[model samples]
Target: MHLRALPLDRAPVRLRQWVFLVDADERAAEAAFVALFAPGQDPGLGRALVADDGGGWLWERHQEFSTWTWFAFGPLGSELGFEAQPAETFFWLYGAPGEVFRGVEISVSAPEAQPPSEVALSRHIDLHRCVSCEVFDGAARIWTDFRLREGGTGRIHVANHSLAHDEVSRLVQTLLEIGNYRKLALIGFPPARELLAWLDGAEGRLASITSGLATGEDSQAVLDQLLALSAEVELRAAKNQFRRGATESYHRLTLDRLEALRERRVPGHSTMSEFIARRLLPAMRTREAADRRLDDLSVRIARSGDLLRTKLGLAQDRQNQETLRGMDASLQLQTKLQGLVEGLSIFAVGYYVLGLLGYLLKPWLHGWPGGAEIVLSGLVPLVLVVAAASLHRRKKRLIAGRD
Candidate 1:
C-alpha cells in the first residue's frame, strides 16, 4: 500500500503535456536525472527528479523500463525539439537500456466545448484521422492516431472536465500504459509467423517418420528417427514457453487497460479497443495456435516413440524364447551323453577289479604246488554291479547338487 502511494508525478504541465517511457534500467535513468538537473541544484530528490531547466523532468524508475517526462509545462520539450535539448543535460537518456518502446504526447485543458487548436497538434500528430473518446464520465476527451508519427511519437488531446492534478496524472499514466502493454503483446507476432513455418517443416519430418513406422520398414531406423524428432520438438517447446506466456500475459493486461478506458465511439475514428483488437487479437491467436501445435507435436512424438519401443520389446522377447528352447534341447542331449559315459566308466572299473582278483586267486591256488592257474570270471558280475551302483550314486549326488 505504501509503495503504491509513492510519488508518481507527471510533468508539471498546466494545460498540456507529453510523456514517455523508454526501455531503460535504473542506472541509466538515474544518470539521465542527474544530467538533466545541475549538480546539487534544488538539493532535494528521490526516485523522481525535476530538471533545473525551464521545463522540469519527472524521473520514474521501473523494473524493466523508465519514464522521463520532459516538459516546460507548455514548452521546450526535450524529445520534440531533439536538436534543441542540450546534449550535456539530456545525454544520459542516450544511455538508456534499449530503444524507446512506448511514447505519448498529451494535451490537457480546462472544461471547453471546443477542442485545443490543431496548430500545435499538426507539428507532430496527423490531425486528419484521429480516434477520440470521452472517459471517466466525460471528465476528459482524448484524441489520437494510435500511430507513431514521422518523429516516432504518439499523440493525444484531452479536453479536461475540470480534473484535479492527481486525476490528470492518473489519466496520463493509464494512456501510457495502454501503448506500452500493447507493444509488448504484439512482440510475439513475427516470431509466431516464423515459428509456424518451422513447425510446418517439423510436421513434415514427423510425417515421414510416421510413414516409415506404418510400413514396418527397418524398425530400428524408424525408432531412431522418432527419438530424434521427439527431442527436437521438446526442445522447441521448452524454448517457446516463456515467450508464449509473456505474450499471453501482455495480451490480457492490454485488454484490461482497454476496459478501464471505458471508450465510446468517436465520429470519424475507431476506439482504442477496436483498433488494437483488429491487429493484436489475430496475432495473439496465431501465437496461441502455434503454441498448441508445438505441444501436440511433442505428445504425438512421445506416443510414437512408445509404440516403436513396445514393438522392439516384443521382437526381443520372441528371440529370447527361441534361445531358451535351443538351450533346453542341448541340455537333454548332454544328459544322455553323460549316462553313456557313466556306463563305460563302470565297465572299465569292474574289469580292472576282476583282473586284480584273478591275480590274488592264482597266488592262493599256486601256494599248494606253484603250478595251477586260477579263474576269476565268477566274481565279474558282483564287481560290475558294485561299481555300477557306486558310480550311479555318485552321479545322483552330483546331479542333485547341480539342480
Candidate 2:
C-alpha cells in the first residue's frame, strides 16, 4: 500500500529523525509496528503514520527489510530534544521485534548566520569523507559523513531556507529511503566477497575437469567430478540468489533517490552521488561479476556433461558392434557343425539300407555276389547328394519362416 501523506503546516525550524532498518518477518514487523505506534490497529497496507505531541512516527514494511522513522520538530531556537536519545531508545520502549541492520540520524535546522566550519563538522564526522551539496536547486544544503557513530547511527544535517514543511518531510523521506536501500544493497557485499575465493577455486576445478574430459581420462570419474561441482555451484547460487537480486533492486532505488535530490555539488567537496559511486557501485559490480561467473560455470558444466555423455555413447556403440561380430562368428561355426552332422547321418542310413538289400537279394543272387557290391557303391554318391539337397531346402524354409 502507499505511504500516508504527512500533514505539515509550515517548514520546521529544527527537526530530528531516526531511521531504523528492522530485521524481521512481515508478521512480526507488522506486529511491532502496531505495538509501537498504533496498538490494536492493523498495518494491512504495509505502511502507517502516527502523529503525537510535536512528533510523528512512520513505518514501512518491505520485502527484505523494514524501516521506522521517528521525527520531532519545534521552533528555531527550541533545543532539539532527540540528541540524547540512543539508537536503542525505541526498542527499549516497544520491545524489540527483531535486530536492527542500519540506523540513521537526520537533523534539520534553519540556516545559521554563519555555517559550521570544517573543524566543527570534523568533531561529528571525518572531514575528509564528509559530503556536502545544495539540493532542490539551492533551496537547502545537506551534509553527512555517511559514517556510523558510537551509537551505531549515521548522521545527516540539512539546512532549510525556503522549502515548505511538506517539502522537508518529502526530502527527509527520500534521504531515509536512500540510506535504508543503500544498507540493504550492501547485504550482498560480504557474501559476494566470501564467494570470490570460492569462485576462483571452483573455476580452477572446472578447468581441470574439462581438461580431463578432453584428454580422454576415465569418463565415469570425470562425470562424477562434474556432477559434484555442479551440485556445489548450485548450492552456493541458491543461497545467495535472493541477496543478489535484492541488492540490484536496492541499488537502483538508491540511485533514483540520489537523482531525486537534484544535487548540485559544492565546490571543493564531494556530493552524495560521487560518494556512492566510490563506495556502493564497486560492491554492486562485484556482486554482478559473481552472478555472471556462476552462470558461466553452470553453462560450462552442462557442456562438459554433454561431451561426456557423447563419449560414453560412442564407447557403448563400439562394444555393441564387437559383441555382434563375436555372435556372428559363433553362428557360422554352428551352421558348419550342423551340415557335417547331416552328411554323417546320410551315410549311416545308406549303410543300413545296403545290409537289408543284401539279405533280400541273397536267394536270387546266389551265383552273382559281386553285383550287390557294385550297386551299393554306385548308389553311395546319389544318397549323399539327395541328403544334402533335402537339408539345404529345410534350412532355407526355416530361415524364410524366421524372416
**Candidate topping TM-score:** 2
lDDT per residue for candidate 1 within 1-403, as digits (tens), equals: 3332213333334222222344434455455555555454431333455554455555555544456565544432423332233554444346544456665555555444345557755665566766677876667777778777543566676766656656666776677677777887787888889889999999899889888888887997997788788888778778777778888887898888788877777677677788788878899999999988888888888888887888889999999999999999999999899778888999999989887876777766776554333245567788899999998898789989999
List of clashing residue pairs for candidate 1: 55-72
What's the true lDDT of residue 322 in model 2? 100
Whole-model Cα lDDT per candidate? 0.67, 0.74
Candidate 1: 10-residue stretch with minimal lDDT:
75-84
Taking the tens digit of each residue's C-alpha lDDT, what string does model 2 give over 1-403?
Answer: 2244544434442333343445444466456546655765567767666776677666666675556666666743322222555545364235535556777776666434245556655666676778999988877888888888756778787777667647776777788788878878998999998898799999999999999999989998998999999999999989988887889999999999999999998998898889888999999999999889889989988888899999999999999999999999999999899878877877776677667766776667678768767766776777667766776788899999999
Clashing pairs in 2: none
